[model samples]
Structures are given as C-alpha cells and as structure tokens.
Target: MASETDLGHALPASLSRPVLLSAVGRVMKSARAAAFTAEEQNSPLALRAYDLRHAAVSTWLAAGTPPPLVAKWAGHSVQVLLTVYAHAVDGQEDAARMRIERALADDDEAA
Candidate 1:
C-alpha cells in the first residue's frame, strides 16, 4: 500500500487494480457469507470500483451539477459526457416547459 502525508503528496489516490480487486473481493465474500437472505448474498453490490464511479457521476448529473463541471470532474469532453450519461439527467420536460412559459409571459407583458 502507498503511504500518505499530511500534505497529501505522498498518497496515491487509489490502490493498484490487482490489490484493489483482491481486497474488495475478500470483503465481498465475507459480506455474502453473512447476508441474511439468498437474494442478498447474490446481489451485485459494489462488485467493482468502476461501479462506484458510475454511480457518483450519475448522482452528480441527477443533482443538477452543470454538465461542463461534471465533464471536467469525470475527465470527459462535454459531448462525450452527454452522449454517455444523458439518460441520468432528469426532468428536462418540465423544466423546459416552465422556461418556455416564462418567456411567453414576459413577451406578453412587454407588448
């Protein structure tokens, strides 16, 4: 394992892939053994570190983080981010409708 310092320079952000998989596999195996139900034991919870990254990105999109910011954080170009994760963005229909309605109302008042 890598060592860390208070300055954060000595730390590696993550375990090497092989070491991470070994450690997570051991934990998952123990958790499966202790699961109360067969379905619970069989569920694919935290199966890989990549799954957590996907969840985090999806969550950020759902929480209304700007696409550009999310793209930067995820190390993706904005176009690629939208192409891959657009489905995670929610309620565009209602929001768009509200904006259009406000625009029309403003035009009516201006006229």
Candidate 2:
C-alpha cells in the first residue's frame, strides 16, 4: 500500500495494475511532449516511471549517503543495494584518499 504522501493520498492496492500502468503511460507521454527535447523524445529518457526511482537511488549513492540508509529508503537489503548501485558510486577516489589521510593524521597526533 502506498502512503498518503506517496501520491498525495494512499493508493489502494485494490486499484487495477492495468489502470495504474495506463495512467503512468499517459503522464509520460504528456510530459515528454511538453518537456523533452527532440532527441530526448526519441531516446529512452524517462521511458518509464521506474526510471525515476533508479535515478534517485543512483543519485543518493553518488552523493555519499550511507549505503544502509539508502538501502532502507530504496526498500532493498544492504547487500542488494551495494551490488546494484556499486557502479553508480564512482569518482570518489580523491575523497577516499583524503579521508584516509585525515584518519592517519589524527592517529599520529594522538600518539
């Protein structure tokens, strides 16, 4: 069951799946017509509403959100979330090195 906040009101599971999918298709078509560029309309951008969820999950992971917290939000186990989103969490080598350096510096200061 969807929460009230999910769609501004709870979407009863009793709603037909076909009806929901049809509605999403209609919305996608209209949004594409209004907002998409010529090339974007031809491409698979926002091809399905599920793509938005995928983007959100990827963005959260890349933004340094904790894997456990992101997994909870995405309704996946930590292991599954890491497996799926590991590719999206790239370009952090410099940040990782800085963190390691800081930890070592702190340790040396304490000694």
Candidate 3:
C-alpha cells in the first residue's frame, strides 16, 4: 500500500487549508441536497447502494478472485457472502443439473 507521502508530492503552497475546507463544504452541501431530492430519494440508486456493491462483487467473482479474498474485501462473512451471492458464485449447481440430465439420457440410450 502506498503511504500518502509515497502516493504524491506535498500539496503546493497555493493549496491552502481554507481552500480545501471550502471545496469539501460545497461537495457535502451538494450531496446532502441531492440525498433529499425526491428523484434521488425514491430511486433505486438511492435505495440500494448495496446493489452497486453486489454488482462489483459479482464482477470480481466472475473474474476469478477467490471467495475468501472477495468476502474480506466486501466486509462480509464467508457464509453471508455465499448466501447473498450464490447466483454469482462459480461452480453453480444449476449448471451441473443440465450435465447430469444429459448423462442420464446417454445412459438410457445405452440401456
């Protein structure tokens, strides 16, 4: 992990504390107002930041990141990770079902 100092040089002299604070204040104000707006308030985006998180996790899972690592990154228990993301987990049972059925059909043909 890169420390703050390692990530980049120190802020220039022109980037003062008051300037940073003012910019942060404006962003917070805008975010607060957006949070309360009816469109944002009732929309799925506002209702479930978790869905976005889920999508990210699903992508990570599909990309072959190990379950334990993904769970740790997601701040979820392994059990909870499995329960919530079963559909996205690799080696799904439903995929096996079709293969099993085909094997049975092949056996019937042999019989």
Candidate 4:
C-alpha cells in the first residue's frame, strides 16, 4: 500500500531518486531485521522494496494470468517478460498439465 506518493503522506518534490530508493531500502532492511532470523536477514532471500514488483509479476503468472497481459501490466514487452520471468513461469508447468488433464476429462464426459 506504500506508494512513492502515498495519499495522506507526502514526499517533498525536491528529493531525488537515489534518496527515495535509499529510504525505501532502509525501510525494507528494518522490516527484515524485525521479521527474519539473523541468518535469513543476511541472506539473498531478504526482500528489497524493488523485489515487490518481482513478487507481483510472479504471483500474477502463478495465478494464471496470460503472459501478454502480465507483460502489459509490468510494462514489459512479452519477449522481455518471458525472458526475465521464465524461471517463475517454469514452476507452473505441472499445474498447467493438471488443468489440461481436467479439461480433457470434461470434454470426454460431454461427448
């Protein structure tokens, strides 16, 4: 819910991108420190604010959003989206297969 210019909270327009990014990074760091063990806090799995976008794209893909739509949402070309998100999409192969199997069964019953 936190936005670069969230309602009810205002960032001074004079602030630069680096400053804003650093502030968000510090907030993410503190949140991780509170929620994670020391080892996990130190790990690469520690989430940065930028990681939020990645998580959203991955979640949308996993939730069965089509690639072209996800690409548009992320402001990426379909090729770029697939190239970058191929790993996240790869995890859905089994789910896709199961869906196909169920559809085939439904078709058989309808016939």
lDDT of 2 by residue, 1-111 (tens): 643533256656666234668888899889998999989999998889888899999999887888988888898999999898888778878877888899999999999
RMSD of each: 6.3, 4.9, 10.0, 6.0
lDDT of each: 0.76, 0.84, 0.69, 0.81
Give the number of the best model, judged by TM-score: 2
- Which pairs in model 2 have colliding backbones? none
Going through the candidates in the order shown, the clash numbers are: 0, 0, 0, 0
Name the candidate that leads on lDDT: 2
Shift of residue 47 alpha carbon in model 2, Å: 0.8
Q: Compose the digit string of candidate 1's lDDT tens values, residues 1-111.
A: 666644345655474234656887787677667854776666676555566688999888877778998998888999999998989886667766787899999999999
The reply for model 1, stretches above 4 Å from the true place, is 1-38, 95-111
How would you encode candidate 4's per-residue C-alpha lDDT over 69-91 as one tens digit per residue? 88888889999998988877877
- lDDT per residue, candidate 3, 59-111, as tens digits? 88766667888888888888898888877866755756777899999999999
Stretch of 10 with least lDDT, candidate 3: 1-10
How many residue pairs clash in model 2? Answer: 0
Full candidate order by TM-score, most accurate first: 2, 4, 1, 3
Give the clashing pairs for model 1. Answer: none
lDDT of 4 at 20: 69
